[model samples]
Target: MSFTLKPRNGLPYAIATRLPRFPFALILLPMLLAGCEAELNLAAVSQETSHASLRTDHYQALASNEAVSVLVGNDGVVLVSPDQGLTWQRQQLPGKPGLIDVDACPDGSFIALGFDNRLWHSADQGQSWNVHALPTEEQMLTATCAPGGAWWAAGGLTTLLGSQDQGASWDTTSLDEDAMLTTLQFLDADQAVVTGEFGLVFNSTDAGQSWQASGNLPDEFYPHTSHFVSLDEGWVGGLNGFIYHTVDGGQSWQRQDTPSTAPIFNFSANRDGLFAIGDHSSVLHLSGERWQTVPTPNAPVYLRAASSGDDHRLTVAGGRGLLLNLDTRPALAAQAQ
Candidate 1:
């Protein structure tokens, strides 16, 4: 038999079925109330506390500088590892927000983007964070710290956010077109590119002071992730299992074939070279004029973020707390020899 139990405060009603005992409502009333109360009180707890150690946390983003490596993920948790991926200390932001992406700034700091239009900054190598609010209500997709000490973030509806003073204040810019800017990356101090829906490609040469639209990506290709090695050379991965290379600074692109059909989600570079990660444990390494597939221990889980440490190793993070370190020092040594 099934029955409806309406919660207090007009929260909503939950139905229970297949009861074998008498006084079911009476027995479950307090338990339901307690659960509701606990759920309500969960948000009251501050997320600034640090975890005892790193667990299998579902990390969404990873970034690294010369000194530290940082990983951010769901439940507002940030993990910092100073010794590459050897050990980590976990910290959290208040309210347990979901951090989608993180980028290493030029000043040895990191900037992470929250799903709730928030920016989290950690100057002390992801040990602590200062949260800053963006000026828009649109969902932020990516955050980047340029080489010139400028911070930039982009999101839906061509929204571009910038701050020159280390995020003390922010300036908002929206383009004339109606498109979601998915990725904003700076190849140098002043050269950057932004790609988004409708094959949109915008370039900035003056530290984002001005932007110019470049050639459209073919076949309405929507970029899932991008990596630019220089001002005129870059790669963009898409949902259709295709990777496009551009030589003329986004003016045109040529598609590169891959072994996997899963959606490519992220890209990073280390001493081994450029790497891309995506669904179905898809990991690609740029080796000698071709994109080579790299085997992963975990399969079928979407890998979203990757970063390279000062040790020249690449660290990748993904769903279900999946973390993997790709060490190519041996290969580098062999090649050197």
Candidate 2:
């Protein structure tokens, strides 16, 4: 379970409690007490916030806002939390399709992609769904909705589709086959980029109307996720622990180093920095230009996706119900066994 509060203008923080949850603690000492006494009690209060760890089936994707958080995964399994993930309920969807990725819109709607290369939409926060077909049959890996009422989907073997009518239908763009397309991101109403297997990265300028092949590095780099903080600066992470950075709007790229060689399945970005999560206990962090490692929990699941909201809280979702929240405040831990 998770808790959501309206965010103040503070640094973005994500905290993922480990295998056994610590009591989530945000110390607020009562002012009515003697000042000296309250100061001493503050430390003790932080020790009492522990509760049961949230348990559920393996999760594949997560999305959220100030009010709702949704986790989707295999067998049409969906969990929705109204209170910023502090509480959850099983949300019944229409099909048993293996859900691959999900995107939450600003207007309380949700869109999901799956194994069959189809798009599913829910107006009621994942309680039900309906399918929207793409232009191709390649397995749809990732999708996003733009602010200007357009939707885009990218997937295997050079498959790219664009929808102008909010995904009622899609048109096949001319950027045809080379490798498996894995991820897509729209920087704004007019610009977008797509990445895939064989180190393929494509850029679009006219609202995905056309494309330009920009980055083609080593053959093994399959960029599964991409995040752009600005129109010029961005990063892509994928298989073989691959991470590439670009500054001139994909004009050129450079590699970043991390200790773990595990595949980086996904990334989430906010005002604070960039964070990537993946297999083999790998969490690569970028605060400025230099990259570092953020240790992850000892769960046996590849963290597949992350959603960073406007608030500082970041929710990372993966297999075996691996949900980790990394934040600034200290969570109350069990007193060392």
lDDT per prediction? 0.70, 0.61
Each prediction's TM-score versus the true structure: 0.80, 0.76
Best by TM-score: 1
TM-score of 2: 0.76
Q: Write the per-residue lDDT of candidate 1 for residues 105-193, one digit (tens) a residue.
A: 87888898886778888888788889888888765778899989898899767889999998788888887776668889887888889
Give the per-residue lDDT digits (tens) of candidate 2, residues 1-337.
3423232111111132321111011111111111110111122111101222233344567877556777777666677767555556775456566676788765668888765667888788777788886768555667777657667787655777878777767787646765567678777778887776666777878888888887564544656677876657778875556688888866677888655566676788665567787774345566455555554454445667577766555566665456666541221121111
Candidate No. with top lDDT: 1
Clashing pairs in 1: none
Score residue 22 of candidate 1 by CA lDDT. 14
